[model samples]
Target: MAQIVISRFAPSPTGRLHLGHAFSALAAHDAARAAGGRFLLRIEDIDTTRSRPEHVAGIFDDLAWLGLTWDEPPLFQSQRMPLYGKALSDLKALGVLYPCFCTRAEIAAEVAASGFAPHGPDGPLYPGTCRALTPDDRAARLSRDAHSWRLDVDAALALTGPLVWHEGDRAIPADPRIHGDVVLARKDLGTSYHLSVTVDDAAQGITDVVRGVDLFDATHVHRLLQALLNLPTPLYHHHPLLTAPDGARLAKRHGAPSLASMRAEGVDPVTLVADLRARR
Candidate 1:
């Protein structure tokens, strides 16, 4: 008997579902359907400040209008804070997490003053400013100021040694240090994307992690977290992003027409699905 293939398309409810989102959701859904397996939907509403209930409703409407269906009701990240907390606690027990006190402005100033900040997939990597804080200093600051919990990548790598993850038939080496000490939980939200997604994927038994190639770099960090948390690493499928006629990637910021707008304009869902499948 073959192993069951489970895939997911977890989208944040920060904005309307655009063309790129459709492409990604369809890719994950089609892959699962093709394998006679399960496709799951997850609402990544960890950013409480920006996440909107209306946008989440829009996501469901858009995916349904595109003729896509999920195996279960969507998993909302906002409701899984306890699970993320447990993962963070486990990492902390392993001495692989520390409080990061640097604000965004501070991080930028440090990077700018360095004059040669090494760039990662997300632009200038964090400078590890708070990684060297003494226990007393950390305690003192914690008493008054807010701080994020960051994964001590160097320490984590020391424990896990080296790691690799499967992307199709190829084994890719993970280089999570490129991200420096990534925040596992924020001062305000209490959970970060890296921590929540890694935990949820495992919890949901997601066997095949499918998403846009833009998140390929994020897999390195996710793989490391899996090792530290004693979770199973899933097979990855980082598909190419759909682009507009101008050859630029479709994005919410780029004013890409949303699926809702297309629906309102009387575009046929079947025709749209066929067009997207052709692009793949």
Candidate 2:
């Protein structure tokens, strides 16, 4: 018997959905539907500061307009804080998580002074300033300064043996250090993207992750998290991103037209879906 594919389209409720967002959502929806499997919708609204109720409504509205529906009611990240807290606690107990006291300015300054800034998927790699903190030093900083928790990737890799993840037919070696010591939880948010995404994907029984190519590198970190937490690793599908006419990736930051705007302008949902499928 073949494995039943369970996929998801998780979007943050920070802005309106765009053509690029439609592309990804449709890909995941179609993938599961084509396989007679299940597709899920997860509202990644952990960043409460920017996650507005209107944007969440717009996401559901736009996805409906695109003729996309999930297998069940959507899962909201805001309602699942305790699960994240538990995952963080588990990682902390594993002794692979450490407090990161370096601010953005301090990290940038240190990387600049070294004059050899190696970039990661998120940007300039975090210089392991806090990773090397002595127990007394870390304790002193923790007494007063607010700090984020980072995974000591080197330490984590040592705990696991010869890890690899699948994307379609390829078996890519897991190299979590490509992202350096990634933050597991934030002082304010109580969780970071890497941790929440890994935890939620497992909790929802997501058998496949269908997203953009931009997140391809982030999978390395996710695979490590899966191993550390003893969660099942899902097959990943990093599809190409829809691009603008000038060859730039279609994005809200680049003024991409939103699906809601198109819907208001009298665009037919069936016609748009057909067009998207044809282009695929």
Candidate 3:
């Protein structure tokens, strides 16, 4: 038999747990149980501006209501800033992180000038205006003003060989052109989702990652980060997302029905499970 370890369901406490959240958590729990392994819960509350402590309690209550229990005290990202900082320092020491000075408006202007959106998760691809700066030029900029830190794809890839991952039945490779150099740290926030997530998964020793298919495209980037940090790449299983009747994915801002809402409406746990199982 294969070595079975731990799998985790990490949800950001920026919003209440929804049906989609319940599905992902259940998937992780079931997989770990089937493998005779451990299940863990982690709070991806790195977004300090949005992640509230009350939301964290709501998540725990929702999961508990579903009979889903984590192995220990939930790991919170905000408390792990030092670890993220160390990882950032490691990347910087390896010359894979550079400062980014371009603001949203500046990048928008560049994108408009280019007549196309640059390639990135956010759509406005970074123009790489700062990528060409010399060491002294970077120092001068750093000395005069503040800037976010971005990962240099070429440098990171060169250090870590090919950036590829197994996405379900297919093997995916990183496309630098599309992903470009993603931000690792903002001037205000110390860590980005890509950096903190990869680090936390490794720190928690997650052997399998159960999430939605929307994050399938990001698997390659996460794989690269794992390689860079010398961490194990967990088996990824991206399930179909729960969308609205009109074929739109649920958004927190839209006030989509959360698990609490559904339960309050007398929807049973079995109903939720059956609904998701029917999708697959």
Candidate 4:
């Protein structure tokens, strides 16, 4: 019996989907199509402050315009707060999560004062300042202070032992501490990307995770989260990003033009999809 390949393309509704997003969505869709399997769509609108209702509607419209469809209705992260909360509670019971009350400025100052702080994929890692808080102190702070919840990576690894994740048949060693004490829940949102995405993948029974190379390193953290949460890790494909002629990767922050804007300019979705497939 052949194994059914399931892939997903998750996009945040913070902005419109760009060429880079198009390439990723098409890649996942085509992979599932080629395998005669399931392709899922996930709306990663976890950042409530930034996510907009209009952008969510735009996601459906743009994918429809591109003639892309999914095996099931999309999963929305905003509605799954309790699932994430339960995962947090599970980790809390495992004694691997801690309350982090340090603000960004305080963390930066501590790192700067250290003269030689360790760096990760996203600059200086958290220095574990709050990890050393006493129980009574933590409780007192928890009473009045707005704080994020961070995974104690060292403690988590001790519980899971050494770990690895898969990309195709390749078994990449997982560095659980790569992102050092990554936030599992933000002060404002009860869930972070790593925690929510890890939980959702299992919920959707996603078999293959297809995403851009920019997140390749983050997979190490995701792999760790999967282990801690006792969820299955999916096979991964981190595709190279589509970049501008000047060599910058296409991104919303860089003001990359979106598929909706392109369509408004009379760009043919069929032609664009064909071009994207050729590039793939």
Candidate 5:
């Protein structure tokens, strides 16, 4: 038998736990429990514009209703801003971070003019508008106050082992250019997803990350960030996503019954477990 250390379920508290979310949470909890390992929960509420206290409360209720328990007081992303700031400062000190000034509209226009189709999760690749700026030019852009920090792809790539994430068959490589200088901090918040998640996973000592297949690509970026920051790389298992009868994978917009909603309708906890087993 293999030894299990730790696993986690991190859900954005912006929405309720739908079927997809329930499956993910149950998968993590069940795997950890079966292995006699620790299972943890994290509230990914960094996107303040969408995250609500009510939603966070609902997540707790839904998970409890499903008979899932997590170790530790649930980790909240918003409260960890200071840690993220420190990581960003470290990267900046190493000259791997730079500021990005292009707005969404400007990037769109540039993409349209270039006649290139958008690819990947974030749409069109950023054209490196700020990559070649001189010190004075950089200072001028900073003065305009329209910039957000970005990882210098060239420098970031030179730092290896962080960009490697394992799928079942093989390891996938993350080239920073594919992600195109993601924003580490935005004007709206003190930290970005890349920075916060990498820092938190390392700080919490997560050994394995179990989540939906949709996030598989994101692992590449996470691996890169983990390497750049010199954090331990956790094993990843991206499971199949639950889909609606219509064949679309379950999503927040479905309004189709959620796991909590199913519980409210009186479905037994054993039933959920059976359903998970059937799907697998």
Candidate 6:
């Protein structure tokens, strides 16, 4: 018997789904369908401040309208805080997490003043300003000020030794240190994207992670998290992002039209799906 293949398309419900989202969902759905496996939907709504109920409803409606069906009811990130909290506690026991009290302005000033800040895929990497805080200072700050919990990447790498994860048939080496003490929990929310997604994938028994290539760099950090948490590392397939006719990446910020708008303008879902499949 062959191992079951499970993949997911997780989207944050902060805005309406666009053509890029459709392409990603269809890719995952097709991959699972080809393998006679399961395709799951996950609502990445951990950013409660921005996530809207109306947008969440629209996601389900749009996916259904596109003739895509998921095997299981969608998993919402907001509902899985306890699981994330437990993961944080486990990492805390390992002594690899530290409270980072730096505000955004403070971080910016530090990075600007350094004049030679290390850059990561996302831009200038965070300088570990709070990582060196003494126990007494950390305790005092925790008592009065709100702070985020950051992963001590250097410390974590020391314990895990080295880590690698598979992307398709190739085993890629993970260099999570480039990210430099990524926050696992924010001041307002108890969980961050890195922490929530890693924990949820394991809890949901995901076998393959299918998403756009934009998230390829994030896999390095996720791989490290999996090792530290003693969780299974899933196979990763980062498909190319769908771009507009202008050759730019499709983005809501760029005023990319939503699937809902396209549907209302008399575009046929079947034809749209065929076009997307052909592009792939």
TM-score of each: 0.98, 0.98, 0.93, 0.98, 0.92, 0.99
Query: Taking the tens digit of each residue's C-alpha lDDT, what string does model 2 give over 164-215?
Result: 9999989999988889988899878989999999999999999989999999
Model 5 lDDT at residue 58: 92
Model 4, 1-280: lDDT tens per residue?
9778999989999888889999999999998999999999999998989999999999999999999999899999999999999999999999999999999999999999999988998999999999999999999999999999999999988989989899888999999676889999999999999999999999999889988889999999999989988899899998889888899988888989999999999999999999988876
- The root-mean-square deviation over C-alpha atoms between each candidate and the true structure, in angstroms, is 0.9, 1.0, 1.8, 1.0, 2.1, 0.7
Which segments of model 3 are wrong by more than 4 Å? none
Span of 10 residues, lowest total lDDT, candidate 6: 1-10
> Taking the tens digit of each residue's C-alpha lDDT, what string does model 3 give over 1-280?
6777688988998889987787778888888898789999999988889989899999998998888887878998889999999999988888888998888888778878988765666576687888988989999889877799998888888888876676656677766546788888988888998899999998888888888888877777788888888898888889887777887786676666898888898988777777775665
Q: Write the per-residue lDDT of candidate 5 for residues 1-280, one digit (tens) a residue.
A: 6656688999998777787888888888877787789999999999989999999999999888777888899999988888998998988987888888778788788878888754657777777777778878899878877678877777877755335676645777765566777788886787888788889999989888888888777777788788778898888888899888789888878675776778778889788777875785
Instruction: Identify the candidate with maximal lDDT.
Output: 6
Residue 214 of candidate 2: its Cα lDDT? 94
Q: Judged by lDDT against the true structure, how good is candidate 3?
A: 0.83
lDDT of 3 at 191: 90
Better of 1 and 3 by lDDT: 1
lDDT of 5: 0.81
Q: Clashes in candidate 6: how many? A: 0
**Candidate 6: deviation at residue 19, Å?**
0.1
Pairs of colliding residues, candidate 5? 162-223, 162-227
Sum up the clashes in candidate 3: 0
- Model 6, 52-74: lDDT tens per residue? 99999999999999998998989
User: lDDT of all predictions, in order shown?
Assistant: 0.93, 0.93, 0.83, 0.92, 0.81, 0.94
The TM-score between candidate 5 and the true structure equals 0.92
List candidate 2 stretches off by more than 4 Å: none
What's the true lDDT of residue 41 in model 5? 92
